[model samples]
Target chain A: MDRGRLALSLIALAAALALPFVAGPFWTGLATQMYIFGLLALSVDLLLGHAGLFSLTHASFFAVSAYTVAILQVRYAVPTTLAAPAGILAGTLLAAVFGISVRTRGVYFILITIALGYVVWGVAHRWSSFTGGDNGVTNVPFPAIGGVGITSHTQYYYLVLAVILLCALGYRVLIRSPFGLGLRGIKASETRMQSLGYRTSAHLYAAFVLSGALASLAGVLYVYYNRFVNPVASSFPISVEAALMAIVGGSGTIIGPFLGAGVVLGLRNWVSSFFEMHHAIMGAVFIATVLWAPDGLVGIAARLRARFSRPKEPGP
Target chain B: MTQLAIEVGALAKVFGGLAAVDGVSLSVPAGERRVLIGPNGAGKTTLFHCITGTLKPTRGSVRLFGRDVTRDPEHRRTALGMGRTFQITNVFPDLTLLENMTLAIVGTDRRKWVMHRAVAAFADVRRQALEGLEAVGLAGRAAQPVKLVSYGERRQLELALALNTRPKVLFLDEPCAGLSPSERQRISKMIAGLPRDITLVMIEHDMDVALGLADRVTVLHQGRVILEGTPDEVRANAEVREVYFGHG
Candidate 1:
């Protein structure tokens, strides 16, 4: 809403619109992946950044939705309209059940989510007949509604960009709402919040379900784009990485998670080309981020902006 | 006869083997300013917690306006017209003072659940929040985060938060615990200025502030009320002097 943010957003939008035309297919594909993973991270942050809940079971919802869409589309020939909504619903229902994790806090919440994630991953991996085992459901066609079909990756890229933009706008509105402020209040002090007539646990549970639903939405987008699904989508690593992307980018802000996704996925793609142990570099990045820039890239940028701009402003 | 705003019968709170609040009974009438005073470890705060529903009593009952509410949760008690300020100044540190007030204003009402619209869009909430701040002499610091404000200001905001909940019975747990003398006077003045319709229950270590504000005083020693009377009677009691003043 500020002039600086508006200008920056317009520039980012123009670049996103032009990337498919200007860049190669590989770059466009990578950018699309960034947006998808970015959405996943954003979902994690809805709890992590605002409500002070660090969830690691988000991959369960993501993968559950992805598997649902993949199986419905590939095995049963379900249309995108039904398959997509069904995927999101399955994931969200799972979230509603998994949402009981709100009963625990701190490391216990993380451990429970990790355990729940493995349950989903285990089913996806061990249940060979239904889930296609390790290979997962494959040959899923691109999302098509009615007569209009996404015939090319480039066309799908635009669809994803539009969805993410709309989601970001909604997320912005949500964080500014009274419910959003209540989440921040809980984050600050749950005891005080309870005394203020807030049912803190219920507030947190609602946020968890909503975050899971958003992550499920991302899963739908991902399955359509990747054209397949696998147990890796449900694995613990994916959940950790989604959370890490939010942290490395800026856990609280909208653009921070996307920026983090870009850094992470971009690093992995570029590093894995030559280095066999690229994960070490990722670990180092996380450690350095935690040690020096705990607020992520957004915090660093904010500090830099303040440093440079404060000198020019008149005394308060 | 005046109605009792708060009634506690045979209340006791035990933590493991220790009874923090051992078998205490208290009744405060509507529109009375009742102050609970004692030496350290006398269970004043523990008693407040049980009455406010922050901690469940091991045995006994708490009633508000003749309605038994011992089974209710803290928020439910708050909804039932009970509000309290913490001794250690509990508040939302990251939120602006106005936002803090807004939470309190909407807390007891259904409006706290409104999610679609931004908080600022609620013009009435904003106006009420400002008025709440103004009442606590914090209107100038409305835009500042609670963390950035002085401790004295946070204490005021703490009282402001409780007041905005619109409780019929208000509890203050050492509201001026760590304030300067001037700050203490300001807070006591705010407490004194509150309408007589709002029943006040306070715990104060400062005897001057305690006696000046109380319609009646209850003296506690070792988790039991040793004496209860007017300020003059409490001050002149030989047992109070022997136990409270540490001399016969």
Candidate 2:
């Protein structure tokens, strides 16, 4: 990584680590929520930005993990830690299976993923005996590491931050790896990659599994933080929010989605405090951002910096 | 009598009602440099696609290194020591020239799945990629994004990508299409300098280029091979002269 990028990453990490100390209870809770959403947004960006796969079913995997944790802890008497891995495993496996069928290019893939999301939502909603149907799974417990339990809001906030940081680092490493290059190769030209001896489907499937696993991890954190899981967790609006965060942050950069999550979630909290129509405000912001900053906020900033910086001559 | 690098026996490909490639049979011996020349709609590109496994033959078989590769996918074919370049320049425009060649080398490498390992960590891959770029004279432009390079350079990058795979048989589709006269001469020289062990099969529109580079030339007309001989024999053939080489 270049010096500028390294500096930016360290600064962002520092800000995140310092947020809990300065913010109040309500603000801290919101910030924690944003961090979880940031993880989800980043996972979505892996598929959309890196793999060039537009998936609308990511929230399905999220809700699957959330509901898995809820059902295992509340209904089956399983501990939260064991149940968290189980949920993530289920979500990853399901996403991998769906990826096989949904790996087609263009709008077909998007539609298939959307249909898969609806199918997951329908099952969760209809299976009332296990999922509690529309009421959702409730009384989910805080995650614990052996004897050290996340009991308070502050402790839970730190826990979410730790997981987010670890996952983000893993994402960074994965995106810079050979597998990541293969995905980018697929994105650039699937035919060319195929001609170069890469099975593009295998790369896409791996990306789908990784994205699903990350989304599931976020879902597990979300359920633990909120102490509840609802059908709305798998709703289209949640998926839209994840996509919007990714797009608004600049999908080209790995950290853009997380940055976008912070800004969008912060704005939502600010707007909802004064207005009854939070959705309308968010919708307006989405429209405006797409129009004015199609490359996203990071792209806009990069453009400005480039405009003011000293120009370099073209290379030989 | 030398081992055949590629052998096509009665290959045919039909798209809906039209036969894109029809009963085409040809053999390219190992270490041979051959050219396929035909006017537009002679199925030159279609034959290249079939050989590379992009389009499966409706009948007959394609053998690479005497092994039947008719059922393999394009990637499998590439892994089986057949490399191809598109008629239109195909390169990662967003990536640097070095990165583009590195990606090709990485693809050909067996250890491509180990995530988090720096691609440059492998000294051999880096060396091979640089060597491939040097072969096409793009070594100095290594760090420049392919999009920043001129059109001729992009073509060279495409050749570098194909060469990076270290294929036994290299198939180039119109490698000199859209180059200036000087650029064409440079590419012709580069092609002529390739290792003798690497069999070169190319589609060329320019008769002078075909005559200069190819040890053997095959002319395709209406999806079938009309003539196959030495460049002099092909140039002297009455049918080839009348159907293809005649002035418009």
Candidate whose lDDT is highest? 1
lDDT of 1 at B104: 91
| Model 1 regions lying over 4 Å from their true place | A312-316
lDDT tens digits, residue span B67-176, model 2: 99999999999998999999988888888887788789878766568676766676887787788888888889988988899999999988888887879999999999
Per-residue lDDT tens digits for candidate 1, residues B113-162, read 77788999999999999999999999999999999999999999999999
| Residue A207 shift from truth in candidate 1, angstroms | 0.3
lDDT of each: 0.94, 0.87
| A1-316: candidate 1 lDDT, tens digit per residue | 8999899999999999999999999999999999999999999999999999999999999999999999999889999999999999999999999999999999999889889999999999999999999999899899999989999999999999999999999998889888899999999988888898998899899999999999999999999999999999999989988999999999889999999999999999999999999989889999999999999999999999999888676679
Listed in order, each prediction's TM-score against the native is 0.98, 0.96
Query: Ten consecutive residues with minimal summed lDDT in candidate 2 chain A?
Result: A94-103
- Residues A92-159, model 2: lDDT tens digits: 88778777754588899888888888888898889888788999998888887678788899989888
True contacts kept of 1: 0.79
Clashing pairs in 1: none
TM-score of 1: 0.98
Q: How close is candidate 2 to the true structure, as a TM-score?
A: 0.96
